[model samples]
Target: MTIVDVPGSKSITARALFLAAAAEGTTTLVRPLLSDDTEGFAEGLLALGYRVERRPDRWLVQGSPTGPAAREARVYCRDGATTARFLPALAAAGRGDFRFDASAQMRRRPVAPLTRALRGLGVEVRHLEAEGHHPLGITADGIEGGELTLDAGESSQYLTALLMLGPLTRQGLRITVTRLVSAPYVEITLAMMRAFGVEVERRDSPEGEVFDVPPGGYRATTYAIEPDASTASYFFAAAALMGHEVTVAGLGRGALQGDLRFVEVLERMGARVRVTDEATTVAGTGTLDGLTVNMRDVSDTMPTLAALAPFASGPVRIEDVANTRVKECDRLEACAENLRRMGVPVRTGPDWIEIDPAAPGPAEIATHGDHRMVMSFAVASLRTPGVTFDDPGCVRKTFPGFHEAFAALREQWQGLAARR
Candidate 1:
């Protein structure tokens, strides 16, 4: 198989769309990723009355994220949490009525901190179903932002959501975080929002339990989406466990995604790491040295790290990842269960997990519809005997080329077991 270079992931796609829509003028996104979740986000903007057209390979977005100036519309966010979570605050800034709703799975994802923060911004939010969550009936006439207290235990997205919309209100917002984890995502939020048009001042407590986002709307501009480092973790694991070297390209030197730290994890675990402006290369050294790491910030990359753990020499322990529960699935538990089925020693708690290396066994991994779970463990099949993942198609939520890319890389691993 030839080395195939895939586009970025839907996480980058959705954020780019928000940034583009927030900016004025005809913004063209080149070589952009197209998928269910990103497509849903684009359509949500259309529902809010933005003119977005998708050509064969590029998206032509024409709108002034001043967002809906002439009218008000109600948007149902479906299962796109990026849309459901971020757009509400955007609507509040644009001074439009945005009724946010999601599918059963997305509805189950927590949105309380975001909603509470919006209310504190003086944007009235009504929960159509569960209290403090989504399918929210957002009636916005713009925010009279002042001070907001946010509980971001569920996810950092909540705080990021507030920061993105804070700049649009009359009194700019000051967000005080109650209990915040996954702080890197907030950094991502600030980076994107700043690119789009908003300026924010952030202050964090020692443990990251508290944060502040100074009130200001995002500034709009031509922003580029980097290749997803989180998505690249799977392929990195494949290269480190199997006999091949896999390189994922298109990320920049100063790329803002937090999951870019995956390289650090691989380097520490004894893989030879090579860096470039557009790509990352990881190769296995055959022998491994496991290490214990705190993943409170890079929790999303932990799944892929765990996938590679079974190939290590010592025990690998990951702690401070309670936020994994609010993601597309309960990532920590799912990773542990799948690893155990492969005969790896595993232990898990609410906020931590441990895995020991062994001769990996064969098992059918249940992905529980989480894309990361499917992609991470699929690479684990390289060193392990094998794994058949349920709902393998779940990878479409973030990466459509995952299985194909994983397969192509494995072709170089001289004695790789056959993929089903």
Candidate 2:
């Protein structure tokens, strides 16, 4: 059996940085993802006067128990949405003045929901340029941490940021989630918080879901990150498309990422899946039956599923992923446009997309500067020649060596074909 060891999880890596920085002592993160987004997150922590030691195999972070050492600092989040959203909440826990900015692309994303929630929690946040976007000024004397209501329909990161700050609040924190999407990601946040020695009480209510976070801080500890399940989706999709077997090591049945559920989607579409303690394997059956899938909980793999749709025996309908529109690009529109470029028939709605199987020809796929778009569409290149990307390097956001890894997969596939 051949196994591919993918890089560590981006989501977990970002969360580890935030948790480690807020902990009381030194925390070591093992096998973290070293990419543009995660690096941006680490840099943001360093700017707040947190000490981070970067080693080839691990990262050591010396956290400030009271708060950030820097009373006032400016942090540039670059294109990392997690950094842009989570860091401000981390800043709120400290007695300091912070000015947060981001890249031009990140400036277009939404941060107002989180900012509004912060203001309700006694943090002073001002939007410098736009009302609901980045380039904000924040002045916080530490989180008061009382009951607050938040609308998390736009992005679950808002809820996650607030939840992470719950244990740091003066009065503890009770959050009423008005509109929640991507509940699984919140599960990840809760899980990580518990790992850091904080417990959040959760219950389902008529208003929505309620969380009670006790007044305490995180304890520093050693944590190991799992391989990225979202990035592994492309290779899994490759197996489904080309009737090959691909196994991603370091991601097992116990993986924390919700995107690992993507393999279940492939299974429902007639692909074979085997998940063990060591690794998860996806083997194609040379036949794909299109099916309707709701991707609300695992929306990150929407593009990978869309790429595999064209090779299916029937149409694939993906629903409950309107949030994809708010990602790095309007992913729904980008997927539609790219499918049209490849001569595939596609129908789209506000929160759903139906892709009909067709013989896609050679075409240049526009990536819209989204890393997932580039990696997802690259899978189509395996079965259809002349498939190219507009900006392949945009994959540096998460997987800097994506093109090289993809080439290795192709070589492996060719070797398998020669054996056949």
Candidate 3:
């Protein structure tokens, strides 16, 4: 079996940075993800006057319960949605006049739900440009938090931002989420918060899911980040499509990422999947059975599945991923457009896409500057020669060495085939 070492999770690293900054002592994050998005998060923390010492594999963040040391700061969030959404809430809990902006792509994404919740909790939020979009300013005098309601159907980051901000408030926070998508991500947030010393009370009420966070703040600790399961999906897809055995290190049945469930989709498609306490492995069975799937919780793998659907024996239908449209790009349309370019039959609606089985042809995939787009289409390149990406380097958003790693794997698989 080909064992691959995937990078640390972007989600976990971002949440850890927030937790470490809010805790009472210095936090050491072991194996934190190093990428444009994550580095941007550390830099945003520095801009807010939080001390962050970065090394190759670990990050040290000094916590300040009172809030940012810089009374005035300007943070460019780059293309990371977590940095854009979570940092503003982090700044709001401190005493500061912080201005936040993002890349043009991130600026187009909405953040009104988060801002609205912050306003309800009495934080000063100003939309410098379009309403509900970034390029916003937070004039903070510290949060005296109480009860508030929010709609988090568009993105779960809104809820995560508020959840992380809960302990920093004077009265703590009681959040009632009216609508929530990507529920598993919220679970990750709760678990990480518990690890850092705070426990949030969650219950399903008649109104919605209520989270009661107490005011006592967090205590810093050493946290080891798990390897990214979303990044592993690409290599797993590669093994399935090419009939090879691949094992991803640092992920198992007990892994926190909901994206790890992508192997279940592969299992349903006739691949053999083995899960242990320490790792998970996928082996191809030389047969791919297409089926319908709902990927609301693990929607980040939608593009990976879309890229492999053409090789299946029947139509592959993906459903309940409407929120994907508002991601880095319109993912549904991007997948359909690229598949059509490869001369594959595909159809899409507001939230679903169906792909008919075919031998996908050569085409130049439009990356749209989204990292997932580049990584997903790279899997399709395995069987279809001449398949290329318009912007292969865009994978730097999450995995800077993705191309090199994937290429080495291809060489190993080829050598194994030659021996066989």
Top lDDT prediction, candidate number: 3
Please identify which of the two predictions, 1 or 3, would achieve the higher TM-score against the true structure: 3
TM-score of each: 0.90, 0.99, 0.99
lDDT tens digits by residue: candidate 2, 262-295: 9999999888999999789999999999999999
- Candidate 3: how large is its RMSD? 0.7
Error of 1 at 139 (Å): 1.3
Q: 1 or 3: which has the higher lDDT?
A: 3
> Judged by lDDT against the true structure, how good is candidate 3?
0.95
Question: Tens digit of lDDT per residue, candidate 3, span 16-92?
Answer: 99999999999999999999999999999999999999998899999998888899999999999999999999999
Kindly report which residue stretches of model 2 are placed more than 4 angstroms away from their true locations once superposed: none
* Cα lDDT tens digits for candidate 1, 21-93: 6666777776567766787788888888778888767787775646565356777776677888877777776
Clash number by candidate, in order: 12, 0, 0
Error of 3 at 344 (Å): 0.9
| Highest TM-score against the true fold, candidate | 3
Worst 10 residues of 3 by lDDT: 248-257
Prediction 3 TM-score vs. true: 0.99
